[model samples]
Target: MPRKLKVFRTAAGFYDAYVAAPSRKAALAAWGAERDLFARGAAEEVTDPALMEEPLAQPGTVIKRSRGSAAEQFAALPADRPKPKRVAKARTAKVEPAPPPEPAPKPSRDALDAAQDAIDVAERDWRKEQRELAARQAALDRERRDATERHEQALADLDRARRRAQEDYDAGLAA
Candidate 1:
């Protein structure tokens, strides 16, 4: 099995890595090597340094060799077992048609009517709920629009007031 090293960067300045070694020691070694490579400015691939810690290195997160090309590693990885062959059903002459599925028992007329009534009631309630939701959404939209318009009007009023005050000041100075 070809070994794979997955590497990415974190937002911080430190180099974070996950190395899926053949053993835990190998993984630790890989991480140390990556840290050294980063310190020496020899590593090209780096993810956020924040990824180096617990959650990133925990169970499922992938952190391996951040310095090498992931594509090259993926290409280099060996293929597993070959896919199983599909057996053709038509080639087997002993095939017989499957038995038809048994029909479900039908309910009595009164039971069917009651079920239909229940369905109709449920449908009506669903439609009512949909209409209520639509109305609520529309109301919320209207409220938001009104709030925006009010904010704009208030800003305009403030600007006008400031301009008037400035003009009054100028007139007083002139006088």
Candidate 2:
């Protein structure tokens, strides 16, 4: 059987989140609230027909309506704000200039020192790794060059051995 749905409203940050649900638990589920918002007095069943329309139309879906933005809230404030009081002073009143503000205390350099130290350590570690990588590259290049030299030498030795064997065979045949 289909359960009867009711519109529920709650304050979500600066906006109001509304939903049509069968129960308070269903409403909380729609709002994705882990705790009981109704128990916390943050949520309540909305009876206002004007506020209920949108939520009832889309049942179980959360509808966020802006209460007021920061600027709008300030604009909504009462325009009859108290004005600054005007003091009656004689025209000959000599107003002494205020003393210069004292120099502010120097800010702590501990955080800066720690950050610099961390950067220095990082740089040192990076340079160490770069040097290790360069050394490995140099070793690899040397090994490659050595292998090429050995290969050429082996080829020359085999060629000479073959030529000597061929010459000996021709000499024996002639004899």
Candidate 3:
């Protein structure tokens, strides 16, 4: 016979325990088993309240139950502290049919034409701006190149004049 397992869910995750086993011990073992599974690489954290009996599900897990002493105790406990939800194996149910599609709205031809015109005008303006920027950049580059060349030439001329003056002074001294 398949062992009746009491499935419990804790804040961390879910675990299964034999119903014949002690509730406290089984719950603790289940908790440890869940932690071990998590350590071994399980991603989902179980957050269901631990089950008190094998045949019965806990408050958060079950939809309805008689308010016995256990329920009373649960209620007596501060409202702030309540049982967590039970995580169970998902039930297999048939999916509902998809909703019908709605009709699509059509745009007017004038609106479409206006949008196209705006896009074309923007593209033309963007191209014109790009060309103007390129021309300005080229002109600045040429100016910088010419200025550097003139400065270099001026330095060379100064060096030549200094050398010639030094040679003339040496010749006069020799004479």
Off by over 4 Å in 1: 1-107, 168-175
TM-score of 3: 0.36
Better of 1 and 3 by TM-score: 3
Q: Write the per-residue lDDT of candidate 1 for residues 34-81, one digit (tens) a residue.
A: 454544554434344654354345533445434346786577678888
TM-score of every model?
0.33, 0.41, 0.36
TM-score of 1: 0.33
In candidate 3, the residue pairs with backbone N, CA or C atoms under 3 Å apart (3 or more residues apart, or in different chains) clash, namely 9-48, 12-46, 13-46, 48-85
The worst-scoring run of ten residues by lDDT in candidate 1 lies at: 6-15
> Per-residue lDDT of 128-154 in model 2, one digit per residue for the tens?
999999999999999999999999999
Best by TM-score: 2
Backbone clash count, each prediction separately: 9, 0, 4
Screening candidate 1 with a backbone cut-off below 3 angstroms (N, C-alpha, C), the clashing residue pairs are 6-64, 8-47, 9-47, 9-48, 10-47, 10-48, 11-48, 18-63, 18-64
